[model samples]
Target: MIGFARTVRLWFDPREIRQEGVTPDYRFSLANERTFLAWLRTALALIGGGFAVDQFLPGLRWGWRVGLALALLAAGVVCSLRAVNHWVRCERAMRRGEDLPVSRFPALLSLAVAVVAVAMVVVVLVGWEG
Candidate 1:
């Protein structure tokens, strides 16, 4: 099962193979793979954020600490799932020679970042002692 999924993922991974001719499908698949990796990085950052906040602000109340953890975990999960979904859709589109779908990830990620920033500001201003 994992191998099958990896095969499908590879079919869409632009960096996986380089053909002689640079077709539209190939270009889009490559873009898709780049996007997937970007999302994976975003997810990792979110997970790191959870740990950072917990460790750096040990004085935070349990409620705020838990909230931060939950927010970070949720962001990671969302980003990871979106990456997989985008890869699958891009693969399908390439296979069918159809136009790739428009991505709303930039907007979503921006909003998430803003939210995180606000949370961080609040934590520092209201909670942190030094």
Candidate 2:
């Protein structure tokens, strides 16, 4: 409970997090920032892919089309949110000289993308008549 409160506070108040631990080497912080940016780029790609799926696949069945687009969009939203929270967590850990936090997000995200891909293949091969 207390941990959640602190995370919430850190979410809104980044300055407090920065003040909590001694400043680490600038290179590590920059690396973390780069990673955050990479996640943002991935999130953007997911979001764009969602829009593309919706706009480009006019022939796909309505239900399947919407489902795919919504899935991608939801993944994008989750990824973007996770990116920020992860950035905060990592930054704090780095400042405190603790090991970087580990997460299963990458594996989960990969699984999601694989599922979406398989769905796309099935829709394409079996044919979705709209």
Candidate 3:
């Protein structure tokens, strides 16, 4: 059971993230894992938010409803995908004693959420029927 659980964890986690840059300090590796988990949490929140909007907000027009749901879902997927890649890259950099990688996804995600929030406000205030 323990082995199976470990396997499942490895499947989701970047456990092998240190393959390229072995022997980095445990603290660095743990930090990398924490960062990866943070990204995963963000992805999960985005996905959950999408689901909540789709299920609970029935007042929205079909076009707007579906668009918002898809946007959130896509953002979630993007964040998850980027998380793994970023984890691997950062781990490798750490192993090589290089600087941490610059993260573009956070900025992109913040911008996306901001745009969606603004659009939602407009829809609510203006009664956007389409």
Candidate 4:
């Protein structure tokens, strides 16, 4: 059983794998992985914030909840798709010995956050009056 467990662990261990040669662009690959993970975290945060808004603003109208859910789901989907595309672009750049593709994530995320803020303000105003 111990031997079996060790074999299973070895299968999942990154150090156990050996590449035939040094990748000319290992730095780009590592950076790409980091960027992908960052986008994934952003996507998760958007989804979580959507649920939180619904929970915290129970008095909010159905329209507001729907809008929040749609916005967050859209943001998550966009981020996930962008991450995959960015990874592919980085890999291609590395293979061709070109500079890695630049990221527009910061700007895009900022816009999404702004939309969320506006939506929150609208919700608060409507809730107060109703």
| Model 3, runs deviating above 4 Å | 1-21, 128-130
Better of 1 and 3 by TM-score: 3
Q: If both were scored by TM-score, which would come out higher, candidate 3 or candidate 4? A: 3
Model 1 global lDDT (CA atoms, 0 to 1): 0.77
TM for candidate 4 is 0.73
What local distance difference test score does each model get? 0.77, 0.91, 0.80, 0.72
Counted clashes in each candidate structure: 0, 0, 0, 0
Candidate 3 per-residue lDDT over residues 53-122, each given as its tens digit: 7887788888788888888999999999778778777766787788887866778789999998898788
Error of 3 at 2 (Å): 38
lDDT of 4: 0.72
Ranking by TM-score: 2, 3, 4, 1
RMSD value for candidate 4 = 9.2
Worst 10 residues of 4 by lDDT: 14-23
TM-score of each: 0.72, 0.93, 0.80, 0.73
Give the alpha carbon lDDT tens digit for every residue of 1-130 in model 1: 9956865676567665333223454676788789889889989999898888778878887788878877888888888887887776676667666787788887988898788879878987898653
lDDT of 4 by residue, 81-110 (tens): 667666655655566667777877879789
Best by TM-score: 2
TM-score of 2: 0.93
